[model samples]
Target: MTSPDEPHDVSSGVSSGAPATGAHGLGPHVVGTRVVVRRLVPGETGPTGGPAFTDVLGVAETWWPDLVVRREDGTAVTVPHALIVSGKPVPPRASRLQHVPGGEVQRRVRGLWPGETAALGDWLLQVSPPHEGRVRRRASSVLAYGSPDRPLGEALAAIQDWYAARDRRPELCVAVGSAEETALRAEGWTEPADFAGHAVAVQVGSVARLRRALGASPHTAATGTVATEHGPVAGAAPDVERVRVSVTASGDRIATGLADLRGDWACVHDVRTDAAYRRTGLARRIVAGLLDEVAERGVTTVVLHVLTTNDPALALYAGLGFEEHHTATYLGPPR
Candidate 1:
């Protein structure tokens, strides 16, 4: 009898893709659509005819080496991987897979606490828990077998099963690292495109020197201060409520930056300059000064995020010795 949990076709009233009659005196079972079984040859010496391998499905809570298949009546069949027969491929639904935006990706991430998704372009990628200290994701059209003895067909089917459960396409998947990459490539899975690497480095010793360099620049000194009818002020004058400012050469008030000291790290935040003084290397000077201040405080590292598409800003940071650590991608359901 079909299990109550399984969905049945209402019009035909068939469980899984099983037919009305079959050789086991039960019912005609559709080969690939309804139930998948392991095929065992008579001379096969392995666990080919024993049980299904549910572990291959990659379900979060499922144990390893267990068989999992649907019966004609819609009940789950648990057997060794060796017992199942390889079936034809069932194409995935194209509408379910989609490319999501960064905002949507952020919303989804916020919906789940402590879980993160990175957005790179329009693709949002969710990483699985760290395996061997490095995070990994299930690549599309790839299967991970715990052992080398498992049949290739069964491994492929297991990969398909994972995609079905996730409502995702398996053809566009990728695995990280040389080992996993090698395994997938061996199974004929496509590899991701090679790209330049990125890194982030901090200059702990040059912070003060950088600050002096900027402060000594005539352009920075002239534009760094507020101008009054009397004369130009050299540095910012601190006030209680808000930093006081005077109108500038371009009728804009001079802006200021503050150093946020935290546990051997100084974040140079709230950097601003007069409208007429913009792009005069003032910001870089401020950052350098801030870096110097932080280094004096025993800080050795600095980090920040910039939009990947911001070419000018990225170029500046690259020149300053920062490198890309990782790239993020955002994904959404198909439109």
Candidate 2:
């Protein structure tokens, strides 16, 4: 059975780093203790010809392990318990310098080549093999540096070193302003796109007005409903009783939008109007109402992802003052 603390990886062996050590000492290794795997950092084969694990850490959810670390910079890495080695207590800071799951360091470090060194900060670097260069290139991601203590140049240098180590090139580097971009451009990186700005606006007043607007408008055309004694009625909508709103006579729904508390941003997903009510301003009303609901929650900023080709929807969102913050496009190799 899998332990709750060991991190698991399918392509590699289990992580055997000690758990009890802290930033200053070697961690402990348990022979059969259960552990939740936090992450599988890349490792090198040992001189003796066996797999040598480096920078792996696990924790027991119930107890405070020797060290506690968070993904300080937003990035994602896979973590499973099976990657941990049994029979060892984790040290406080065994893998303090290692990348956190989803952290910018880990995301960018994957692209480093064997002889190259990926610089994460003034003191941190990730070194990998040249044979895995392609894998490392795809692993590059953007990271935000907000610390006043760290200069932009220092951060960029660290990231460059990391990419260099992985035999990959950093495509684009974003910092606070043009100065940072200019600095990177001077270092042989070209600008592929312009920096896009985003706006945040809050809706004001009672949600009733927006809800009423949604019902009064005619965008709910695609919605299907069962015919009842009175008229067409859509099936039960998702449970959203907390916010104040009323369903329209045509079974149109208006309620507080859903929020994804797991991430930093909140989204109002899949707002639609009946097909028969096309172009009558119903969709706008629903969106306006949702904006009001979000504003009432004291959330000034809202974000939603839409396909770039979706012109009409993009126009509507743009009319509401939402500008593109950033964009990602997928490309396949030439046929």
How do the predictions measure up, each by TM-score? 0.29, 0.29
RMSD of each: 29.9, 24.9
Candidate 1 lDDT, 265-310, residue by residue in tens: 3333334554555545454444554554555566544433343443
Candidate 1 segments exceeding 4 Å error: 1-220, 226-261, 266-275, 329-335
Task: Give candidate 1's whole-model lDDT.
Answer: 0.33
lDDT of 2 by residue, 18-85 (tens): 34433332233322122333332347665677665444333221112332211112111233334433
In order, how many clashes per candidate?
51, 70
Error of 2 at 26 (Å): 72
**Stretches of model 2 off by over 4 angstroms after superposition:** 1-140, 144-154, 160-177, 191-222, 225-298, 304-314, 321-335
Q: Give me the overall lDDT of model 2.
A: 0.33
